[model samples]
Target: MSVAATRRLNLVTEPILPRIRPAIAALAPYKQGKQAGPDAFKLSSNENPFEPLPSVLEALQRTAPINRYPDATASRLRARLGVRYGVNVEQVHVASGSVSILQQLILATAAAGDEVIYAWRSFEAYPSLPLVAGATGVQVPLTADARHDLNAMADAVTDNTRAIILCTPNNPTGPIITSAEFTAFVERVPADVLVILDEAYAEFVTVPDAVDGLAERVYEKHPNVVVLRTFSKAYGLAGLRVGYAIGHEKVLDSARTTGIPLSVTSAAENAGIASLDAEAELLERVAVIVERRTRLLEGLRAAGWDVPDSQANFVWLPTGERTDEIAAAFVANDLVVRPFSGDGIRISVGEEASIDRVISVATSVR
Candidate 1:
């Protein structure tokens, strides 16, 4: 075509392009942990180093009819979870992962002009979820010790606040909200506002007073409360992608309405069921991880680094301004760790063998 004709055509086509939401267009995409090389210890993502239980693997192998769509409601898994948690099947909701459920819950309750509150530097996804739902994110800063400042979070809530996410054993920083603190905080929150207790790392918690959302049954009293759990970390089913939420039937139904259809696959459901059947063995593996975490914490302390008390299967190093430099050092030693520049580094308690190298690298960096 001639230059004039081509210019006219370009102008017409450009104006026809779909308009993207300014909020979404400005938002950064989610960043996954860096993949490690063959010889490296990938302690970036907080993953269970143990392989899937034999029973779970066998169940996955038995899962057939992949051509068919999965159970959109995940009824069987929900029923099993209901039995375990002492709730009705209607009160249980399953999704591809707890993160997906979180997004669904956010979308269910919050939208433009509403607010969703969470601790800053807790979970990377927390802030993004609300934004995707067209809600404003209100990040309450953590205490100096890296624990959630629940009181501050309570104070930040307004009439516009639609949801609040409490990440127990707050991710990356690694300190759990105690039972007493949680109870008091919940009391302060408005009854109508949704509260999500994200217990993704609950299985690894060894602290005696740490809040157990299911045991507490806060949902029974506060119908707006929801407890989120996952098989990815403890049950070693990250690849399968299964997670659940226990809450009041009505609250869960709202989240269900927002969820993507048939996102949770049959294979994931089967793996979750098999994991439940072999809970004893899987928890025994968690016990090992807890022990390793304890040892790693002690070693870091001995090496002269002031690390926070970590109940989760990871430790946080408050590298501050030197976060990038320290993370680079870890990478040079084949230790792939998650680093938040100008903030800190989160190193997962991975393979037992990786512990020694972690200590060595940490010591050298210090």
Candidate 2:
């Protein structure tokens, strides 16, 4: 075509592209654990294997009209959570999941040029959340035992640090930060800086001294601290997507402000409340997971694997250079496990048969 004709065609067809912020543009989105094939045990995501409680299904059946928007505050669920945790209703804030609350709190407190600190290799999402908020992420490396080095994390805090996330019974690794350790560490952090205890797996803890965020030593003494908990794990509500935070109303207010409106759906809210009502039976399930976790820990150790002692529903195998190879063996044996490249393998406590399969596969791989 002639230059004039080509120019006219370009003008008609060309469209301006929208610019994504460089921080987000370069950021990698969070990846959910890979789904497994039929007949395989899915030990990738730390999901509860049990079916939903009858009450939860009943409440879901009576969910508010889909045409109407959800309650902005999710008041009933939050109020129920408040009573269960011994906090006032305002102190409880509900979100689609604790991760959503994590994003909101970071947005509320940090921005470009500010910093948010968390342990490296804790939650996979932690590294990306700050970058999404246009804030810097400071990742303090965990100690040799696959546990957070409280001293290192405390020392890394700076004047520009706006928030710190502590994932107790830290995801993947499964070692708990003791109550005494947390108390001492929080004392060193600036009072105005936000400290988020991401306790998404709190219900599975069997350790006697694991830090309880709602207990007096954690939240009550520290005004800036907020605790995040989720129903997705122990309560078998992962599909429903409900989680909450408990803290000083003012601090939680910041997260509420930054949160996406009506993100917590009516069905999720009802499920959360119903789950609370069924807490006793749910904790029994948690007890079973803890028992299985103990068995898995002992079995792996007895087989000469140097895995960490976990208080969560998962165990960590420090396969290190052998991570991928061992994870592949498990997959071949119909066990889908989460593998962090060149790091470690996280095996969620799944069915009883899967436990035996895990030990057999790890032994074979070893």
lDDT of each: 0.93, 0.90
State the lDDT of candidate 2 residue by residue for 1-366, as single tens digits. 999998999888958789889888887788888799999999999999888888889999999899999998999988888778788999999999999999999999999999999998899999888898899999999998889999999999999999999998899899999988998999999999999999988888878889988765367888899999998999988987888999889989899999989899999998888888888998998898888999899989988999987888999998888888888888888899999989999999998889887998888777
- Residue-wise lDDT of candidate 1 within 1-366, one digit each (tens)? 999999988888846668899988998899999999999999999999998877888998978698998888988898899898888899899999999999999999999999999998899988789889989999999999999999999999999999999999899889999999999999999999999999999999988899999988989988889999999999999988999999998998998999999999999999999999999999999999999999999999899999999999999999999999999999999999999999999999999999988999899889
Candidate 2 residue-wise lDDT at 365: 77
Count: clashes, candidate 2: 0
- Residue 155 in model 1: shift from native, Å? 0.5
Determine which window of 10 residues in candidate 1 has minimal summed lDDT: 10-19
For every candidate in turn, the CA RMSD to the true structure comes to 2.0, 2.2
For model 2, what is the error of residue 309's alpha carbon versus the real structure, in angstroms, after optimal superposition? 0.9
